[model samples]
Target: MATTFIWPFIILQCVTVVVIVLFLRMFLHRQLEIGMGRIKRMDKENLEKEVELNDRLEKLNEEYDMKIQNAEKQADSLINMAKETAKKMRDSERVKAKEEAKRIIASALQEKEKVLSEATRMVNSKAVDFSILILERVFSEDELSGLRHRVTKEVTGVLFGSDNVGELIRKNKDIEVVTADKLTAPDRKYILKMIEKQAKGKVNVKFVVDKSILGGLILKIGGSMIDGGIAYRVNKAVLELREEI
Candidate 1:
C-alpha cells in the first residue's frame, strides 16, 4: 500500500513539471514573435523615412542646379551686353575722330587758299609797278624822238595796207591820232595827205597830245585803236608775267 501511493505521487509530480515546461516554452515563443514583428515594423518605417529623405535631398539638389544654371546664363548675358555697349562706344568715337580730322584738314585748306590769293594779288601789283618804272628809266629823250617817228611811220603803213582803207576812212570821217609830243608842220602835212589819200575825199583829222604814251602813236579808226606806246607795251608784259605766276 505505501509503494502504490508513492508511485502515483511521483507520476503526478512529473506530469505537472512537463506541463509547466511546455507553458514556459509557448510563452517565450509568443513574446519572441511579438518582438520580431515590432522590429520588422520599425525597419519598414525607417526605410520609408530614408526614402522620403532621399527624395527631398534630390529635389533640393535639382533646384540648386537650376539656380546655378540660371545664374550662369545671366552672367553670360550681362557680359555680352557689356561687350556690345563697348563696341558701340568705340565705333562712335572713331566716327567722331574722323569727322574732326576732316574738319581740321578742310579748315587748313581754306586758310591756305586765302593766303595764296592775297600773295598773288600783292605780287601782281608790285610786278606791274616795277615794270613801268624800268621802262621809264631805260629810254632816253633822243631815243624817244626816234621811236615816235618810227611808230608814226608804222601806223601810216598799217592804215594804207588795210583791205578797205578808203571805205574805213570815209565811214569814220574823223580819224583821231594820239602822240606823246606835238608834230612839226611838215609832219602834220604828211599825215594829212596820207589821211586824204585813204579817205579819197576831205576828212577831218584830229591830233591829241598825251605825254603818258611815253613816245609812240595811237591811231583811232572807227571804234578800233592801234596802240604802239611804251606804256601799253609795259602793261602787256605785266599781263604775261601774271599769267606765268
Candidate 2:
C-alpha cells in the first residue's frame, strides 16, 4: 500500500512541473513577440531619420555649392572692376604727364626765344656802335665835309620842292641846322641864302655840329625831323635782318 501511494505522489509532482513549464513557455513567447515589434518599429524610425538626414545633407551641399559659385562670380567681378579701374587710372596719369611735359616744353621754348631775341638785340647794337667808331676813325675831315655837302644839297632840294616849306618857315621863325662838322664860311653862306630864299622872310639860324651823324646831315624843324644819317640806315638794316632771321 505504501508503494502505491509513493507512485501516485510522484506522478502528481511530474504533472505540476509540466503545467509550470507550459505557462513559462507561453509568457516567454508573448514577451518575444512584443520585443520583435518594438525592434521593427525602432528600425523603421531609424531608417526614416537616416533618409531625412541624407536629404538635408544633400540640400545643404547644393546650397553650399550655389553659394561657392556666387562667391566665385563676385570675386571675378571685383577683380575685373579693379583691373579696369587701374587701367583708367594709368591712362589718366599718362595723359596728365604728357600734358605737363607739353607745358614744360612750351615754357622752355618761350624762354629760349626770349633769350635769343635779347642776344640778337645786344649784338646788333654793339655791331652798330663798332661800325660807327671805325667809320669815324677812317674818314678824314675833308672827305667827311664833301659827303656832308652832297647830303645837304640833296636835302635842300627836297625841302625847297615841298609844298609845306613856306608853312614850315612861317610857323617857326628859328631854323636849326645839324651837321657832322662845322660848315665853311662859303657853305654857311650858301645854306643861309637858300633858306632865306625859300622863306621869303628873314629868320634866325642856329647851327649844331654832331659827329655821331657819320658824314650826313639831320634837319629839325619844329616838331618834325628829317633823319638822313648813316646810323639811321644801319639801324634800319638791322631791323630788316631781325625780321628775316
Candidate 3:
C-alpha cells in the first residue's frame, strides 16, 4: 500500500513539470519573432539612405563636368578672337605704312621737278647773257674803229631788207646822219646812194660829225634811229634779248 501511494505522487510531479516547460518555450518563441522584425526594418532603412547618397554624388559629378566643358569652349573662343584681332591690326598698319611711303615719294618727285625747272631757266638766261658779253668784247675799244667799214655795209644790208626797205620808203622823211669821223665826199655820196635805193626815192640827208659815236654812223629819222656801230648794236641786242627773256 505505501508503494502504491508513492507511484501516484510521482506521476503527478511529472505532469506539472511538463506543463511548465511548454509554457516557457512558447514565451521565448514570441520574443524571437519580435527581435527578427526589428532587425529587418533597420536594414531596409540603411539601404535607402545609401541609395540617396549615391544619386546625389552622381549629380554633382555631372554638373562639374558640364561646367568644365563650357570653360574650355570659352577659352578657345577667346584665343581665336585674339588672333583675328591681331591679324587685322597688322594688316591695317602695313597698308598705312605703304600709303605713307607713296606719299613721300610723290612729294619728293614734285620737289625735284620744281628744282630742275628753275635750274634750267636760270641756265638758259645765263647762257644768253654770256653770248651778249662775248659779242660786246669782240668789238670793244680800238677793235670797233677797224670794224666801221664792215658795220656800214651791214647796216646798208639791213636797211635794204624786205621789211625795212618798205618801212623806210613809207616814212619819206628827211634823215640826219652823224658819224665819229669826217665823211669823205665819195663815202657820203655812196651812203646817200644806198639810202635812196632802199627808200625807193631820192631822200634828203643832213650830215653832222660827232666823235661820241666811237666809230661808224648813226642815222636818225623822226623818233627812230639806226646805229651802224658795233658797240651800239651789241648793247641794243642785249637789252632786247633781256626784255624778251
Candidate 4:
C-alpha cells in the first residue's frame, strides 16, 4: 500500500511540472514576438528618416549648383562691364590730350601774332618818311591775285592732305565736318560716297559752319578729332617756332 501511494504522488508532481513548463514556454514566445515587432517598426521609421534626409540633401545640392552657375554668370557680366568702363576712360583721356594740344597751339599762335604786330609798329615808326605808294601802284590787281592763288595752294597742301582726309572720311561714317563755309554739291557727294562704301549703309554726316576753324575743314568723329585746317597749321607752326626759341 505504501509503495502504491508513493508512485501516485510522484505521477501527480510530474504532471503539474509539465503543465507549468508549457505555460511558461507560451508566455516567453509571445513576449519575444512583441519585442521583434517593435524592433521592425523602429527599423522602418529609421529607414524613412534616412530617405527623407537624402532627398533634402539632393535638393540642397541642386540649389547650390544653380546658385553657383548664376554667380558665375553675374561675375562674367561684371568683368565685361569693368572692361568696357576702362576702355571708355582710356578713350576719354585721349580726347582730353588732343584738346590740350590744340589749346597749346592756339596760345602759341596768339603770342606770335602779338610779336609780329609789335615789330610792324616799330618798323612803321622808324620809316615815318618812307612811302609804299610806288610799289602798291606798280603791282597790278591781276598780278596780286595770281600771287594769292599760289600761296593758297601751298597753304592748303601743307595744312590738309587729300589722302588723310579721304581715309578719315571712309573710316568715320557718323562724322561732324566743321568748315568756315558750306560745302559745294560735288564735294558733299564725294564725301558721302567715300563713307558709304565702308559703312555699307547711309552715312550720318553733319555739317557745321564755324569761321573759328579759319579755312579748310575739321572733322570730329566719336573720340577722334582730325585737325586739318588753316588755323591749326598756322598755330602748329607758331608752336614749333616758340619751342625753338
Candidate 5:
C-alpha cells in the first residue's frame, strides 16, 4: 500500500508538472502572438504616416511647379512688353528725323529764292545807270537841249501810239511838227501854209532851241522819226549796240 500510494503521488506530481508546463507554454505563445499583433499595428501606423508625408511632399512639389510656371509666364510677358516699348521708341525717332529733314529742305529752298531775287534786282539797276552814263558823255552842250526835246516828243508819241498821229502828212488831216524856235514867224507860217497845201491839212508846230544840230532841221515823215542832227548821228553809234547784247 505505501508503494502504491507513493507511485500514485509521484504520478500525480508528474502530471501536475506536465499540466503546468503546458499552461505556461500556452501563455508564452499567446503573449508572443499579442506582441506580433502590436508590431504589425505599429508598422501599419508608421506606413500610414510615411504615405501622408509623401503625399504632403508631392503637394509641395506641385505647388512649386505651379509657382515656377507662373514666374516663367510673367518673365515672358515682361520681355514682350520691353520689346514693344523699344519698337515704339524707334518709330517715334524715325518720324522725328523725317520731319527735321523736311524742314531743312524747306529752309534751303526759301534761302535760294531770296538770293536769286537779290541778284536780279542788282542787274536791272546796273543797266539803267549804264544807259545814263553813255548819254551824258556823247551830247554837246548846245545840241543837248534840242535833242532832248525831240526825244521827249518821240517818247510821248510812242506812249500814245495814236493811229491818227502817223508821221506821214495826208490831205485834209491835222499835222503836228517839231521845229526850232529860231525859225522866223512869217517864214514859218508861209512854210506851214505850203506844207498844208501839200498835206491837205492844218499844221501845228512845236519849237525847240537846239545848237547840237549845228544847223539842221528835223522832219517827221510817215511812220518815221527822222534824226537830222549831229547829236543823233553820234547816238546812232550807241543804238547799234542793241544788236550785240
Candidate 6:
C-alpha cells in the first residue's frame, strides 16, 4: 500500500510545473510585439518632418538664384551708362581742344600780318625820300642855263612880236617894261635914250643878278611871264606830259 501511494504523488507534481512554464512564455512574447510597434510609428513621424525641411531648402536656393540674376542685370546697365557718359565727355573735350587751337593760330596770323604791314610802310617811306634826293641831285646847273634861254626868247616876243602881242601892247598904257637885271653904264645910256623916244620915265627897271636865274632878261608888262630860257620851256613841256597820266 505505501509504494503505490508515493508514485501517484510524484506524477501530479511534474504536470503542475510544466503548466506554469508555458503560461510565463506566452506573456513575455506579447510584451515584446507591443514594444516593436511603438518604435515603427515614431520612425514614420521623423521621415515626414525630414521631407518638409528638404522642400524649404529647395525654395531658399531658388530665391538666391533669382536675386543673383537681378544683380547681374543691374550691373550690366550701370556699366553701359558709364561707358556712354565717358564717350560723350571725350568727344566734347576733343572739340574744345580743336577750337582753342584754331583761335590761337588765327591770333598768331593776325599779329604777323600787322608786323608785315608796318615794315612795308616804313620801307616805302624810305624809298620815297631816297627818290626825292636823287631827283634834286640830277637837276643841277644845266637846269639853270636852260631856264635863262627860254626867258629871253619870251621877253623879246612880248616887246616886239609877229603874233598878236605887238597889237596888245600898243593898245595898253600899262604895258611898261619891267626888268630885274642891273643897268650897267653902257646898258643904262642906251635904255634911257630909247625910253625918251617912247615913254619917258614910264619904263621902270628893277635890277638883280641871281646865279639861280642863269642869265636872262625877264619882262612882265602884263599878267604874263614870257619864258625865253631853254629850261623853263622844257620843264613846262615835261610837266604837261606828266599831267596826261
Q: Identify the candidate with maximal TM-score.
A: 2
Point out the worst 10-residue segment of candidate 3 by lDDT. Answer: 229-238
How high is each candidate's TM-score? 0.47, 0.51, 0.42, 0.44, 0.46, 0.38
Q: Sum up the clashes in candidate 1.
A: 0
Error of 6 at 126 (Å): 4.4
List per-prediction Cα lDDT, in the order shown. Answer: 0.81, 0.81, 0.73, 0.68, 0.63, 0.57
Query: Compared with the true structure, what per-residue lDDT tens digits does model 1 show for residues 56-108?
Result: 99999999999999999999999999999999999999999999999999999
Model 6's lDDT to the true fold? 0.57
lDDT of 5 at 108: 91
Summed backbone clashes in each candidate are 0, 0, 0, 0, 4, 15
- TM-score, candidate 5, is 0.46
User: Candidate 6: worst 10 consecutive residues by lDDT?
Assistant: 205-214
lDDT of 3 by residue, 139-195 (tens): 675565556666666665665564764486558668888877677798888878877
Alpha-carbon lDDT of model 4: 0.68
Residue 135 error, candidate 6, Å: 7.9
List, residue by residue over 112-165, the lDDT tens digit for candidate 2.
999998998788888789777676688877776686678767766776567676
TM-score head-to-head 2 vs 6, winner:
2
Off by over 4 Å in 5: 1-20, 124-245
lDDT of 4 at 230: 52
Candidate 4 structure quality by residue, lDDT tens digits, 1-245: 99999998999999988888888888888888998898999899989999999999999999999999999999999999999999999999999999999999999999999999888556543333132233237767666445433443454454334565556656666787676556667666755565565455676888888855545666686667877655565556555655696
